[model samples]
Target: MAYHSFLVEPISCHAWNKDRTQIAICPNNH
Candidate 1:
């Protein structure tokens, strides 16, 4: 799995499935 950061604030949280083919994410602000 991998992640990215923004210039202002944290954007979101994410995760990947066992095979690395699927992914899920949650917006940090919401």
Candidate 2:
């Protein structure tokens, strides 16, 4: 799940975010 953050940032494109349910569970979402 934490691995997904890598894609979340670049792909965000305008302060957007993908489902953070997984990110919230991640140990490195900080």
Evaluated with TM-score, which candidate comes out highest? 1
Give one clash count per candidate, in the order shown.
0, 0
The TM-score obtained by model 1 is: 0.40
lDDT of each: 0.50, 0.43
Position 12, candidate 1: lDDT: 45
lDDT of 2 by residue, 1-30 (tens): 455555656533323348544323233434
Off by over 4 Å in 2: 11-30
Q: After superposition, how far is residue 13 of candidate 1 from its true place, in Å?
A: 0.9
lDDT of 2 at 24: 31
Q: Pick the candidate with the highest lDDT.
A: 1
TM-score of each: 0.40, 0.22
Clashing pairs in 2: none
